[model samples]
Target: MAREGVTMPATNQHNEQASATPNPFPEPALEYGENPARFLVEELSVDDGEGTSGELMLARIRGLETIELCGFWLAVERALANKESREPRERVERAIRERKAELEEHGEGLAQTEMTPADRRAVAAERDAESVAVLVDEGGEEVSWSRQSGAAVGASR
Candidate 1:
């Protein structure tokens, strides 16, 4: 089944085998019902003592509607945890800041304006959909962390 852009296997045939298989990377300390498998994976190049090498890492998530906010939070966590160098770490930090700004801008529209609970929910949903559209248009396949101004992007509450 597809939830947002994430695809879950149609059948449970692999459930038993998947449970038996060990995860190649360390399991993230996330809450229950937060499926780490739905997180976007990226191969990042890291500088080792000898030379630069690539490692599998979690990138900023693109889809998964239910956990969009949580996924972005986890992406920031993963980005911080994985980077040791100043330059790379700063880049990740800047990206996260931009994403947060986007969310805040979108949220600001809802502030000061009073509406009924149902109206509030509808407006919130509209803002979320717009945010996703912005992300998709700006980042294409992956949410770009590069600095940009104006439009709100990424996930918010």
Candidate 2:
């Protein structure tokens, strides 16, 4: 069933390759898959809180690669956040600065009012997982992932 403000196309966004550690979120439209080649996920709608915006979706439009550009920029941001070393962090930050300039000049053309389906799901899952991890760690339990079930299990060190 589709939500009130979201519309997704029917696409198999799941990764077929089985790994030693499986992904906890396996729904195709819910998370980023292991395969980079599988790009098209689903269409989404965008709406303002005041009901003043139009619907926009992930589509291969003519002469418009805004979705791809947005995804690349997001990946760069993620890499910057995940990098711990100063050198790598500095490199990503530099790239981000350069991209920010370009975005400032052309952002209006590529502005998205709603999150992509995969991104929305990933964000929610990440937040939930982070909260759970923090709670577990606070309880003095070493949080570990189970390879067989792909669930986070509390263990004693």
Candidate 3:
């Protein structure tokens, strides 16, 4: 969902071909199937003092118009920190630059307040998964995903 500025060739996976077999009815139907997992949130949310902010974020994200935009929001949010105007300029600049390419890709002036039903489910899963009681902290490191542990087994390279 790159919004406005950066340009890159995107994978056009949304395209689907018509069924090879012909139907006697003459009309055709659209085929649709893609695992919703790609839209899933990747990391845990940082617990800022007020637990309410995260809940709000999730709620707002669920309201976003498309799954594609929701995925982009997750990226931009992760790249940002500190709402304080007093924070260092470099930090804000970095955050903006980190997402500039994406901002460009999403096609101009997009709003962040909506989501598709599929987007809603993906965000809901992320929120539900956040409630899990135990997690091994790899300390800002990468870890291997384990179906058994449902945790990062070790630092990701």
Best-fitting candidate, measured by TM-score?
1
The whole-model lDDT of each prediction reads 0.40, 0.36, 0.37
Model 2 misplaced stretches (Cα beyond 4 Å): 1-88, 106-157
lDDT of candidate 1 over 1-157, digit per residue (tens): 2234332332123676445422222233232223343232222456566532322222332122233454454564465455533233444345445555554444422223576545767877897655333333344433443534433455532
Candidate whose lDDT is highest: 1
Give the alpha carbon lDDT tens digit for every residue of 1-157 in model 3. 2334432221223333222222211111111122112222122366677444344434443344444444444444343323222332343234344444444455323334686445656777798666343334446343333433445444222
Query: In candidate 2, what are the lDDT values of residues 1-157, reduced to their tens digit?
Result: 2333332222333344323222222342233223211221211234547532212211322113334444543453344344423232343334445555544555423344576545655776787666343213444554444432333445422
What residue pairs clash in candidate 2, if any at all?
A: none
Error of 3 at 110 (Å): 16
The TM-scores of all predictions, comma-separated, are 0.29, 0.21, 0.20
Model 1 RMSD, rounded to 1 decimal:
16.9
